[model samples]
Target: MEKEQKKNKKPAFVAVKGIYEIMPAEFPWWDRFLEVAEGVSKFYNFERIETGIVENADLFLRSAGGEGTDVHKEMFFIKSNKDKWVLRPEATASVARAYIEYGFSRLQQPVKLFYFGPMFRHENPQAGRYREFRQFGVEIIGGENDPVFDAQAISLASRILKEIGFKDVVVEVNSIGCRVCQPAIKKKIQKYYRTNIKKVCRDCQTRIDVNPFRVFDCKREECQEVKKAAPVFLDLVCSNCQKHLKDVLEYLEELSISYELNNNLVRGLDYYDRTVFEIFVEAGSKGEKKEENASKLAVGGGGRYDYLIEMIGGRPTAGVGFSFGVERIIEIMKKKEIKIPAQKNKYKSVFFVHVGEVAKKRSLKLVEELRKNGVGVIEGLSKDSFAKQLKMADKGGAEVAVILGQREVFEESVIIKNLKTGIQETVPVEKMAEEVKRHIK
Candidate 1:
């Protein structure tokens, strides 16, 4: 009876509500995405950089701004003895912190960096949004505040999405100007909202007083209606901001990347300034007429944050970067039924199947030898049955299966089976690695 109770006891723990595990089956898709991202990063000559996952809470509050931003509210705080730390809500602020601590400014102008990691956000879980999700981002920091960098960042992001099989990509870009012109634009928006305050939501009412630019970011039905007639930032931007935006647009045109001028698209973050852009993918083919009212979900976005470094205690530096939600990208791929082929190293395409304890021991030594010889090999040594082991090899898509049995082990030889041709041959132990390569060819 006691034994029965022990067997029936329920699990004492479960995964946290919004957190998830990436199982082995889903690794191929992730590996393929990272391969493409790395390839793009290499082509652009961006160095990979990683920052700590936990940081001072003030880092985000200062860089992302006060209560008006989502990042500030969604941050997960922790108490470490006397010091307060927060799981990094985003990478931009952390990267900026690194730039300051490492004195990256002393190295080179416009130091290019890329990162891939998980970010924590305490938000409502949805299709693509999660409490914890992976992000792939790039940052170009220091140097002159060139509009060309803006266009280059967008181009790199677009190229990554295209390479990952996203079709009908669209970039919506806008400029909110720098501190010089943004104040005037904010006043115009503030005045407009003050007049239509009754028609707007409670959130927009507060947004008008704190961050008027965020008024346009509201999605409330009533607020959207009121925002339709709200003042536009493009018309109020100073001449420098105007020319900067114009140059960015022209550079994008030269790259042949299509874009829509969305004057109302103010990104939800506080650090953004001057040019901001978001990348979206149409649900279907380009031939299908897209509805003007049809909403395109944004998979990735970023913009210039010229003041963020200074805000995070670094010297004033021009910075531009973009981050893509890895989960969202994978979700879109699955919805489109896009199949990612398993990434098999050509040299490691051989699978080893062994039967009985003697063969299993011999197979382990043989596999290590093959690896030492620069041959990639896979094996199911833990699996005892020969049939089950062969099935696993087939499932792994191995080009050839190296089979060994007690009899073959005793004879100091192995069997090389061509999985595709259904042909088998016996090769001596000393020549097995060479024979496997020949079979692969």
Candidate 2:
């Protein structure tokens, strides 16, 4: 009875909620993004870097705004008997940790690095937001506190999005004051919120004492209403911050990058100071409806974090960067029906077809030989039907097909067939590579 019940028990297994699988069908979009990222990185002189996915939890806790912040609330902690570790919630913090640990600070000034990987955040998934999502970004660290680098980073991000077919890319930029004037701005916000706290949302009410600057990041209509009347960061910035922001805007204008100087654009972090900005695809572009929450559709954002390195135990090094959510970019591509141009590589333009048991057994060796000669030989050796194999070669858009059968295998030769035309020729096995290359060319 126990054995019968055990045999009848249904298998209980399903993917975790909020997490998603990136299947083969969805890889073309991913490949397009990565291809663009690689090309841009090379053009911009950014070196690629990758850090461990798991790190000490305190690495993020110390860098991110403690409590009430998105990172603090959504960070996924890995359970362990020893010290607690976590799957990194963001790449910037991990990059900072690596820079300090690897002594990148001692290298050339402003070491530019690019990274692409998954981040884990246990947040409610929506639209293109998932628990496990990919992010590719470039960080410029260890430079003089220069506004030009800020513009360059922004330009790089804008260039990437536009290259990938996003239209009307507008930058929402702001300066959240420096440490010298931040306290005063926070005090003004607190005093203003204290008087009309009732009009604000519950989150903003708590933000009043915890981190008054965060009140600007609130999305609630009631909070936004009260926030409009509250203290603006630009109104309270010091002279140096004012000059820095003005210089950044001038650079943007010089580059012809569209931007809006928003006083309410306080990014959701404590470590960001001076320059802060977010990149958005303006609604009404590509026939998108202009919704009220269109600002919430930010594809990417980052800013100058002069204090982030110091906060994470490195010397006070200046850093600026921006990241795009891969899922969000892919979603927009699908929605807009943007056609990513198929990669054109001569190596991948040829297909190999085989028939009979002997040819099937020998096809593997021939395929490897072609691959060794820098040819991307694709095959369907498992299919026993010769007609079906040829059909597949045509469907794959192969310019040429290398055919082999039991007789050809015995003769130590391969039939070189032009897939576009019906012309065919038998080539000696020793000269097969040369003939295939010539035909494909």
**Per-model TM values vs. the true structure:** 0.92, 0.92
Give lDDT tens digits, candidate 2, residues 1-441: 122346767457646877867878788888998898878887999999999999998888899877657787898888854877889988998999999999997899899999999999999987667899889988999979899999999999999888887777889999988889888988988999999988988988898898888888888887877877777778799999999999999999999999998888877767899998898875333566667656446888899999999998988999999888878778777777778897766576578989899899999999888888877787888888988888888788888889998999999999999876889999988888888888877
What are the RMSD figures for all models against the true structure? 3.8, 4.4
Clashes of 1: 1
TM-score of 1: 0.92
Residue pairs clashing, model 2: none
Could you give candidate 1's per-residue lDDT for residues 151-253 as a string of tens digits?
A: 9999999998888887768999999989999888888888888988999999899989988888888888888778877777788899999999999999999
RMSD of 1: 3.8
Candidate 2 TM-score over all chains jointly: 0.92
Residue 373 of model 2: what lDDT? Answer: 84
